[model samples]
Target: MSDRYELVLTCPKSLEGLLAEEAAGLGLAEVRAQVAAVQGLGDLETAYRLCLWSRLANRVLLVLGRFPVGNPEELYQGVQAVDWQEHLLPTGSLAVEFSGHGSGIDNTHFGALKVKDAIVDQLRRDSGQRPSVDKLSPDLRVHLRLDRGEAVLSLDLSGHSLHQRGYRLQQGAAPLKENLAAAILIRAGWPRIAAAGGALADPMCGVGTFLVEAGMMAADIAPNLRREQWGFSRWLGHVPALWTRLHGEAEARAAAGLSREPLWIRGYEADPRLIQPARNNLERAGLDAWVRIYQGELATFAPHPDKGQQGLVVCNPPYGERLGDPASLLYLYQHLGERLRSQCEGWEAAVFTGAPELGKRMGIRSHKQYALWNGALPCKLLLFKVVPEQFVTGRNEPAPSQARMIGGQLVERPPAVRTEPARLSEGGQMFANRLQKNLKQLGKWARREGIECYRLYDADMPEYALAVDLYRDWVHVQEYAPPRSIDPEKAQARLLDALAAIPQALDIDPSRVVIKRRERQAGKKQYERQDQQGRFMEVSEGGVKLLVNLTDYLDTGLFLDHRPLRLRIQKEAAGKRFLNLYCYTATATVHAAKGGARSTTSVDLSKTYLDWARRNLALNGFSEKHRLAQGDVMEWLEADRGEYELIFIDPPTFSNSKRMEGVFDVQRDHVRLLDLAMARLAKGGVLYFSNNFRKFQLDPALEQRYAVGEISAQSVDADFARNPKIHRAWRLQALQG
Candidate 1:
């Protein structure tokens, strides 16, 4: 048995109470929440167990010495006065971590360094030997915290941030930090689910952080069990027997948990980049045998499988706040919300979204919404109870707040009259008409200039709620706000008034034009309809036959944003093998094959898109000798390697389900995905990687090992006609002369 000691477990700001509950549940003594930490008392075994178990904590600090000091000198002298020999060996390694609030020690690092020097100087003067400083991995970890003019020093029991968990052998694009993930789960009321048996899922499971945290809670596994080292391991007072006993108890608890339904955990990602990492992490945590991993989109992902209804579904879908287009992301989120309501009716869901405007598109009202931080950006996690129609409420019941007296009466705007055909007021009908005519004129100009696709007007028609777009060989169906009234004559007059102004508003020639009404397609097919202007057309570019769509879907013509990437392919395709992945219409591959590549291979999971790609290749007059495969990219990449000299990887930012796979998110697995591309690249080959994920962080590990550069400027072309930042493009080369 070991002597009991009081301890304090600290967490990041705003997460104090969460840590307290976790500590108390671990059977620690006197566990109570304080300002920014949880205070408790326990034997040495309890301390060991807490270090290994607490998921929400930043680090655990053991109370070593406490002394009140008003100034920096006082802090240094007081720290130096403590018995250095009692706690640490003179020859061991030590590190200092410091944080301060409202203290004289405003520069935390300088204050921490002073304390370190004092301790070492004392040890050297008294014992003729001193400990070395180690930042990467130290033998003894010291912590200094200053709050309100007082310095509090403690011994760090957890060396690295507890969030590391040592289980992540690999990570995906924009993987959530582990501690933040735990905090989110707690905020989402995960502990309640752990108490009751139920399944948990991450529909857009980028690297599976939410699922893994939920699984750890369900299994009651110690968070630190997979960790390679802890600060306490090198503590002067560390007791081997006590640590061993705590480990045994934790193992016993895990054994007891095995009798229950293995905590239901699952993650689905259409992007295969996450599939292997999710598996690797689960296995590292010893939960691989328990959790299920799937590759598919969320839209087609069913709730009740052969067995039954899942208990919970959590999704952290893209908001397009920092990448691509925000409107597109809203559409994606709306689709996801529909999937939650229709496909997962009985299951509870927690959706984390960064953009509020996008959240409104979800249609279903969130029962409860909590604010959290995904890194520095503020995000909202909305909980949907997912009750059936009989139990449904018209609105989300608001949380109660202290009442206040009303200051003024509510006023409502008067409705417009319809009998007069809603006169062409200065800002309403007249304004819309001008915008529509201008769009038509712009369309004619684009056609004359041989522009395959171009914007007729950049939001010129605001009052009639219309957007004008021009595509070669066809005019696009404009996005319009439908008329509210049922009266036919009045609606027709308003429509004419809105359309009359298009030519002048955009300075276009009206003679070379056509207009199409935007009508809702029946059923879910509307979501997947590419664009209305996808009508088949063939044109010659640089003596190469090119096939283009004029009317069929929402985006049939081409992605103007990749003009630069297309040019790059044409430039590099001479006598090389070209690979296009997630190849939308095989446009880039067409350019490459036309550029005289020996071979071009296009891979996509959608046969619909594959057919479109083949059409694109034939339009470009590329030899039919080119290859096209419809399969999962992971399967395709693994089965074939070292085959291509130039590869294009521009994945969809987010999609729930496709015909072949589940959801795809680019932010979760760029590292390994890039590595796969590198492995497949012919010696000294190049990979052009681009993702619309604005929040994407290029893995530092990959950068250190390979030569990578941002080619966004080179990737943007005149067709995009928008900010070049719309997509981040990277050029990666294999290291060699």
Candidate 2:
């Protein structure tokens, strides 16, 4: 055996370019990108350095043997033929992982078992001792992949998935996977942005994944710098002295690249829930001192704090999934366009979304839109360059009061007031004051950190006293709610009227803001349905056609809380059976289906909601294998359980409807819901369950029942651009018994 050998490193699908860039930066030779891996010639030191530094990889696989195979037995024979003694210790523990297609050895587990037996047999016969099998954490990790009937076995130099970069101290709802975040950054040409001192912003930044990733990339900090262990560290051939020297060198390089505010990075949200997590993660990544995160609504996002000719504004907003109507989302996007055109000038902006049609509302021709994968779903990253003057002038709409243009300057005239504090009660005043402060601080934070569109308040704020909560187009305050002397019935009308006056007070076109009101639900009169009551057409500030409608089953017409999860659904729903449970209006299901899923089926007990689901699907032109049914999902699954490749389950936190079901509380019955979902899931399928119930707990029994991963990172979108933890979302996969 040669003392040194050539090795090729593989990354997750679509991350080959990033891996190659990392390899070449490390001075590795022959760096090239393949389907899902990068190939290069490297010695042991080079392998160690790559494993220790590469940010956009899942694992570092060291090629051991390569040959063609047609059957499982040939796979076994090929593994047995390798000189095991050269790389494997007779007594070390090992694990075999397999991934492939188009071969008789198609069953990865079965193929892995065969290869494992062959390795153990070879060791036992040659040295009279067999290596132990440790599936979870092995002393020596092995990867076996087959591409076009050619099998290549390699030693996994990265012990754990490289995504566990070890810098995150805590996670919020819907945090982005580190490797995936890096992949997005690389795909977005983030390095170029950093090199040119461009800003990096994720309007909806869950747990600060984008912020932290951009910071690391900007500072040229190695992703794995904080990781303490690697698969190669346990390899028999690992040289301690060499590894120490490599780590030291890497540390020195990382230290040199550390920045004292090198690139601008910022994040925002309306909800306060995600702010702490974002701050915590940034701090742990050693980027908090340089990155700033704030809480506010996107409508109020202003970039005037810093005087730059142009910058980059990136947003990953919700795609009407797990929220409300697609129409409302369209309105949000339309409002966002208004904000962008008015605030961001001389700036280049990219909108990462699973929903393509929503791009129409932006009103600007995309410079370039790249097809990329968030996971399995097809997503488009639409890029646009904004002219400064367009952003400023396009923001002004017709003022309810007449304005005078004198000396080429527009002058505003105020109307006589009714006085008496405008009947804006103490409680209403408090909520408005808090909201104003939130927006103010958020603006500062965005300017400081280089992020955009953070959340100021999710629908869950107690002060609003709103049942369904709200997502705003722009953060504005008005004289909502009547005085104490007014009757209760009159007060509600006054409140709505006051709400209507908000746009004028904030200098926004009345047509730009859409409002959903709260009213008594049919049969359940104790509860109110704050549904959309009317329609208003808003001409784009940029000469684009826009529509805004309200008067439906939901008050806000949108749920900004689940923005991150909708993006995740769009990213991972392709070629999969997506079952959306408690699917409300099925906006998220529509997004999943639009992401190119094999089929989509939504389940909810309300006929009204089911009909709404159908309408949403129709709105998106989702006429394929999409179905909406009115039935108790729990009973439907228990009776005729269906398997789904991907599932999105968001149930009401507390509900007691007379529509034949008992009281439904997500916190009380999540286990049963999960169990039902698991029974209906196909092998390797994922289930995404979310609830607005602030304090929720996963049943402990689930630890042994499924392979569960919290995917709050994948949930974030641009609109619900604030605290990630406003809603709890999880990813669950079935585990064979």
Candidate 3:
């Protein structure tokens, strides 16, 4: 066998350049970086060095042979041509990994199988015994690449990926991979900091992945030093003396590095559960003496290293992929930036996050950003210099305090009121002035009535057609789709102006404002999801907690305009069987339960909405006794035999859901829907029916069957008094004879 070899190093796609630089430093020659890999030439010792040293590489491949393949027979012939006896014994085990496909080999699995069969058949003919396939571990691992009808086969030299590191047996919900963590630290210039004898801290460390990786890198420790298994460990061509010599040198270097005075490394985790695991990881890496971990929170995050020491503050905060919404995470990032600026004024910082938009909200400008991948998701490594001038928000002021809720009542606003934003135009200033005037008038009543969510403004001006509503501290803005006659550019400019004026005028952060376009809907389009963020927050209405997701659907789970109706349902539902039909999120059912209803049944056509309703019910101590049924409301009403004394129906204007038998229009189907609903209404019980269709007309024939009286005037609340046409309501009951 030749002492020299051609090698390939593969990494995450965007890390090829970094990998090339690393391989060159590890004594490889002719290093050339490709899309997701680097190619180079190296001797056996150089290849072994790369395996033990590379932090960005996922695998290392030592080329065995390269040949042109045109068909399956050629593929088999080429593989069989290689002397398999040189790599593995006839009684040993092997694993084959194949990638890319062509030349009549359409499936990667089939190609891999073919290669395995060729090697096994060749060995069987020679010794009457064949090697078995062991995917997890084997005497040999082979990788075949077919590109443009050419095949290149190689033996994996790194065995399992070098990222395992053997220290992280327990991790948080979403921990960064060890190799990816190393790549991030390198890009953030952690090596330079450590060489200068500086400190490193992670305020949001989870299971100490970052802390352990950073500690190992700073101490000049080989990442895979603890690995016991390797692809070449049992290979037939293995050089035991050469491997032993290299391993001994690495051991000497590590011992010398670890014996010296340690660097200042610390990690803080909010979860106490993660603190022990993080310490375990540090201890396992033999780095427990060098690094320290404490249970702490973001608001009080502080790293008080030696007075003269300065270093990098690194963290991988939650990116809203699994936990909170992107909007909710805004406060976390903003607070992180604040901490860095206030506490570590002269230190550097690096934030690795999948949500760059949230990163932009940090109020500090990033000097550099590197693209990286977290598994399949693309992410950004944001680098910043913690200097006073780098702050984007020039105002060195604390965030505005949020409104508090006590027993679902709007308690009080801050004593300080903010004026209009100086950036607003003449029209925008006027809009802002009007909103303030309305808030002053509506604020007093909302506080007294314990209404935490209400409409602050509703297109009171012709220039800006928008609806602004407040759900506790959050503001939901909906721009009414302007008529075609209006100029689109002018409309957009006015909308931007409106958005700018909101934060200053309302005394809330820009992150709390959610904007959406409002337009008419046909068929099931109205019920269609606008976005799929799945972010939900709880808001109180009449002292009851209800969940509202502003990002996921066109309408929030709770309707502000229907506040009075929900309140009315709670008042009359005591000791009665209450039924809520077309219950979008079962907000009304929650009210009825809190109002002392003996039993409650909610019916809706959407399983999604029903699931949401289940959560809403569960949020308020309600259980299976408060039933939530999934099916067509019409069909369910026809099948339901239980009688309800109090019934509320607030349905869509039109629906053509596939789950239903036929299309439904409130104008055309109200009579049939009401008849079915009224059948189950017990004597002396009242049914409340409501809709939002402005053109809807109630049938005159319904008055002859029962007592039907319009209750639209009483249903309109103070917040929606200007838009009386928002909804129409009626009270229907059995005739008293």
Candidate 4:
């Protein structure tokens, strides 16, 4: 009767039903919810209204046609059958978004190109002109989905997604999308709470997304009122008068609602830099007068006294996805629970987090939890009412299943508890006692020296053949493979004893301990991954940050034995060009760059290590003037033409990597490697050569051409004092004529 057409409203997967309900309320006929989308019959006015008002919908698509196809040619012909003149002028620009796979459309980019070609060809043959593609923003956006040899074509009527509400000009790290934030509020019953004259607060608000959305919902403001444009604005079938009428009515309702007594909407952020941005965003949303933002810490957060009680307190806290440590986030969550319990007695709180295990650390029971998705990550929205019983106080005893929290302090829980006194074997007791003595001695020194990462135990006991390294709160245990002469069962027993005693003696959580076996490596074996977790932890050495993958590679990326050498390099690298050969993870290069080195060149055979080197440099704020090269060190030494004032060369003891042109035995090839590296050195340059070959002997010929001095004693740090044979070093300089 009124030019009826099929329409599809797309939203996030979990919000399809909500979107369908909204569309039905908008008077769209025959509304039905489907997977990730809603379908209905709607004319021009209905489409325009839905485009302007549906907050949950990502896109309002007008179903153009559906066809079956089994090949790329059929797909092209199917798209070409559409009438191009009805959607856009020949000069109008457009973009196609292709998705799914099958029927010869193997790639999204190739499918999109085919669709564009079909459109351009049709327009050119019909009107002698073709529209160009605009990727950023186009007059028309075409969406093509291919599934099981069928193609569904539609026109996207909502451009740039409805989540871009045009209010936020600034954002904190890992900001939540506006639509997801709205869904959180809806799930938490914020709209009903606001209707009853209740207030809202987000103590950890990042750029005020939830607060603005809440303010709009409370004031009856349209979410898209401030948006600059919509896809339907340029569509040929758009009804301008209908859109104008709906927009005017929304404006009148918003004005009337704003005239009422303002609701109390507030946000607080600990970062002072974000306060101004949050305020600016509020002003852009025209909610500056209605909402308030304050710079305050979460520990001291409280609702305004003038506002009503019994509202919603919502926040999307850091989940350690992109930043922060998951282990350390436990304290933040515990503190949040404490504050909410002590300060917000009657308020309801909702915490949206990707890490549910950390949420348990809150020590507060949740009344309800809604499964949600934050983009592709599965997450949960935990809702709880602030009651006195939900707050556990003065319970110093650790929960049986939870980590120990004693005297308001985070302490490691024992791995297991027994009523009878636990007994250790003679060798196991000796290993345990040795770990305790080392902790007392090295722990004092490490704290005094401000070193967060250091070797604690390095095979001090003959039976306990393991190297235990402390990385901040975590410990990395590497078990040196026992000789075949030893009984396999006996060796495994000793290894298990050492692992058990580590946490007990060091007071570390067993979950924080990572165990690996070290043996003779060959042909990229050292670089090969034993696990595919891809988990990286940030640790500090010499006041510089580095990423270490404990679960992935055999090596931890940072060598604890080279601490003093790195320190020496940093001290002497100021304003000089530094070069690092066989720079595994480039720890020395990071130290040099941090010490104001003029520039640096790091060479390694593995791209994995080079990428790690780049991350270490970037983590230390050293991005420019640093070059990382991936090639065999032998080949690179021969080819490098640039001169360096300071060079550090540390070669593996023996490597037969496939990437290398030939096998490299450092003991046999030391002289040749040093000669080539020294040739690229400036006249006054200093070359520091190091290796872990216990029986390495310096070539006398090197002393005949240069001033060579062994600095092994001076280079060994206190942590590796007992293991002096761990490495050897020599400082060489060009002989003065």
Candidate 5:
């Protein structure tokens, strides 16, 4: 018999069983699933096919040798015993990836070094042209695993982590690897669904990993069809013709699948920033025509497939370290469950989350749970059949009961579709009462001004200490961090009472309400990481749509208190150059642009804010002649030569951002900040300076140097009149010469 080489297919932990099943299906013999790997006996051709087709594997290793290793010396000697000449040229390059820890080789770096030294030293010749080390695209890649006191050495036939499928170069902050996504799809029974011409959808499809992986499987396309490089490409034993034939067959199968009608696969993402990148990834995978992506919110995620066609609803929602509020994350999962029960009846739903507690709170009973790993974090894949009976539907619903079959008989029952209302505490009733009263008062004012977002209540009761804001129908509840004097448990209890009172008090779905505790964070930490989920909301302000990320940022993009100021800028922006300094999301610049400003430039130190500003501008068709500068406003002003006819400066109360050259206190730096801005003030130009510092005092020198008028009262709208200290504003103009 020809050499029956050992084949080891590695995968994410808990995926070895699936990998083994796949290997057996692909005609590998004696396949057995082991820890984090599946080993089998296969010929070189079977190994090549496995590299090209195994969707669950991270690497396909061809075992070249195995030997006992008592210490570091034996580890090196074990690798040196292999005939390196047969696999690599004397002048070629090699890389070693060492794993496991034993036999005094606990450090992976040192272990890899030993393996590399052994290979290179064994290949050493008199010509002094020995093999060099190449981490990427090496002539040959060696992998060694130290198990107990033994070592198993192999050659890596798959390069660059097969998870890098060459399609998703751009991804969200916490994107799943392609192989993991594929395994998830398989666990969700996507193959059976796709064969029956069923549809697939992911409500929170970050970079469209699920949608693309599902599409590739449904389209009969090899997961690595587009990958150009492989570890075996440079191997001496690689059969070029055999590989070419396999590749050509994959291409033919892909073309034949593409010639048929495309499957109905779709992905929805709440973040606008990820939409284009997701689409680009789909395009790169050659699945853009088969898969479609849309900008959608999880709260409003309604999966609509072709008529009578229902398949899998798969999503890997953000959880654990990825999100801040456990309560808010519960509502996210609840939304997924609610959408499934109300919309996608008769479908299968798979939710992959690191926090199984959050998954349990989805209010759906999962028939099965699979243990999986996303990196080092232990996660679970909760699989549910989205029938009416599976929905838990209430806080006090009974735990799901297994179907009872007695004496070869089956009991018939209707789907137990029930929903118990969320209970409210005695204190919650008073909180709800206050919310209703405030809503009655502000409802008309909000409607008359065409306001879709406005503050409804701001700690009306000392016990609540919550600010309730209405964004269209969705309610954003921000509970100010409780005082140290207050009991922590009591504060949390009150917050929970307020949350329970919100949806009912506002006449909206509970999923529409998201609660976050507003703790006093350090400088710029709140704005540091945009919620990875991209919870961006587009609300209308001043007759122009502005993107406000209520889920992520501490301050909504539109500062409702500054409505009058933005309106003032908009009123006077016609045919004039408008500048917005420290423009958080460039809301004022958008107003200026919408009001037909000749040009608008916004400056800020946060790249995140600038990106938000760009999206806000694009949302309102305000891209032309508008510039978003990412730098300290002071530095931007000092280097500026252009003059603006209208300027709006809204500085922070205190900023010690590392991005800035020095600390900025509104009280101390207002004069210098304005002087630089004032120098760029064209003759007859108006500059509006504003800050949230309650103790702000405009320098006496500024009044002497320019005409100053305090418009703080005018800038505060009726909604903000309750707290005029929300911000202070002043209009400054160059004195007529």
Candidate 6:
């Protein structure tokens, strides 16, 4: 083998430039960027150095030979012509990775097998002992790239992808790969920031990928130093002395960097389970002391006060993959932008998201956007300098101060009232006064009961037909379609008044208020999406976290009126097998799981709601034993063979989903639905059936077979006290013969 051979360092396609720059910086001669790789001329020492230090490289390869091949026969001959003995011992293990396909090589597995056979046959003929194949931890890893009847073969010198870094023992869902994380940091100018001694933070960091990567780059620590194995470590041409020298130099640099001033790198995750994994990864990377991982929600995220004033704030927020509609993700992006604008002034921000449209909702224009790929998903990295002048609003404004504490509510002076004059008609003024009165009354009750989500006003006035629901600090308004007798312009003006009054009276940002129309539905119209904004917000109820999408549908996913019923189920769910049928969003099931139910099964017809149900369960730390099934609830009930100790059935008043065989009317089908559910209930099990059909009546036949008692009065909470007819509930049990 030549002392200086052509080498190729591979990375994700969009990171070619970064890889090339890194390779050139490492002193590799003739460095050139390819489609998804960087090619250069380097000896064994250079290859070893890259394997130890290159953070953005997937693998380092030593190009062996290239040849034109039109068929497997030619492929075999081309691979066999190479001197395999020079790279691997005759008895050593080997693995072949084949990419691309052409000329009878349609199957990657078949191509790989052919290459392996050629190598084994040539080695056996030359040394009488052929190497075995070890796909995992192979002594020699061979890579073959076949493109349009041409083949290039190389010896994989990195063994596994360098992204492993040998420190991530656990990861959250949809984690950013290590190399991708490194690429994002480099693009965000993390290196320059670190050199200047600025701080870094990832508020939505999952397992601290960005934090750990940034810490390594800041400390000049080798990326792969923690790895115990490398492909070149067992190669016959390996040079131990040169490798040792580069390793010692990297170690000395790391030691010196560590002894200097610490880099203030921090990661905050809402899921506490994820915090430990990040801590473990940082510890394994020898950066535990330099990085801090905290458990906090994004709304409460702020830069550490002791850290420097400016740095990089980066995050890879969820992109509505398993969570369902993309419309629900807009709120997250909006909140992220708000947080960066309000708290991260003077810092640079980089947001990596698969959904670019959601990024636009942030209201902060990006100075730069780079098209990147997170595995197979197309993504964009939005770069921003968090400056006050760049923000569309809330810039140069001081944080709101507590003006007065009414009924335990700290009313902050709203920014809107300061900038714009309050405009209201005589009727609008009356509506605004009613809203304030309701807030004072219900807000006190909500605080006393620890209810973060509750209805403050439900169309109390005739002129202003709207329902105002409070979700923690945010407010959601639902406008009832006005009567046709009223003038359209007049009704619209009144609605504008209510919308204008809500933010000012509640002391909340207007941006936090979402408005939607509620009308009597005909069929599946209510379930159809009104928009594709995909914005979801987390809200709490009785200590359980649930997601609500205020802009996507007619409802906010949670039925504030059902809060009492959910709490009742939770209190009665201990040591019971709980079932939630027609479980829209499964908030009740989440309550049951939190209440120590042995197991919980949530069944819903819509795939969207099932995804929402899964998220709700995960948010509360429920195990996989809490199952969510998507299917027609009636069909599911007929198919279920397991018995449940407790069941909650709260079907929609009416639904005509395409997935269902027939339309469902709760008033007409309540008996059949309840019968099917009760048949699966264990003897003496309690079944709570509830519906929102204002005039619903229990069938006389159901009363004959079960001991039924009305519990509507007990099931309604203080928030829904004024609207007792909002929903009705009943307790049913099998009657002894």
Whole-model lDDT for model 3 versus the true structure?
A: 0.87
Better of 5 and 6 by TM-score: 6
Candidate 3 residue lDDT tens string, 38-92: 9999998988888888888889999988999999889999999989988989999
For model 5, residues 490-530, the per-residue Cα lDDT tens digits are 78667766776777788887766766667655567757764
TM-scores for all candidates: the values are: 0.58, 0.56, 0.78, 0.60, 0.62, 0.63
- Comparing 3 with 6 on lDDT, the higher-scoring candidate is 3
Count of clashes, each model? 51, 46, 0, 0, 0, 9
| lDDT by residue for model 1 (1-737), tens | 23767688877665777788778887778888886678888877777777888898877887766777787788888888778787788998899888874436778778878889988999999889999999888888888877776667888888888888887778876677787788888777777876776778787887777877787778877777767688878777888888888788878777677556776677888888779988888887778877888998865665554356367888788654221133335346645665665566677788877765455446566788777767677888787777645122232232334443456745443222111111233553457555466546655655565555655443344435444455543334354545575464444344344443333344444332343345443322333654443447665443345555534454444665676687778888999999999887788888888788999999987777788888777665665669999887766787885478899998766655545345445676677678887888888789999976668878778888788998887776443444456588889988775
Model 2, residue 240: what's the lDDT? 92
Residue 375 of model 6 has an lDDT of 84
Q: Give lDDT tens digits, candidate 6, residues 456-550.
A: 88988888898888888877777788989999877866776676567667778766777777777866676677767788988887789899987
Highest-lDDT candidate: 3
State the number of backbone clashes in model 5: 0
Please state every model's RMSD to the true fold in angstroms. Answer: 20.1, 23.5, 8.0, 12.3, 11.1, 12.7
Residue-level lDDT of model 2, residues 1-737, one tens digit each, is 55555567766676677678888887578887988778877788888888777877777778888988988788888998888887779998999988886568667888889889999999999899999999887888888888888988899888888888887767765455788777777766777878877876666676778788888888867788888778877777788999899888877876777744456677877778878977988878877777889997876676543435356677777754421334346546655666666566567777877776566556455777777667677778787777634332233443367578999999876432211112233454554555555556555654564332234444334324322122234431212233356675544433433342243333345444443433323333322343444443221211112222234334222354564565568778889988888887676776687678899998887776666567666666776689887777777888865678898888877667776477766778889988988888898888887876668887878878888877666666432455456567787887767
lDDT for position 596 in model 6? 91
User: Which 10-residue window in model 2 sums to the lowest lDDT?
Assistant: 539-548
Model 1 weakest lDDT span, ten residues long = 414-423
lDDT of each: 0.69, 0.67, 0.87, 0.84, 0.85, 0.86
Candidate 1 Cα outliers beyond 4 Å, as residue runs: 1-6, 27-36, 40-43, 101-106, 319-323, 388-467, 470-737
Winner of 1 and 4 under lDDT? 4
RMSD of 3: 8.0
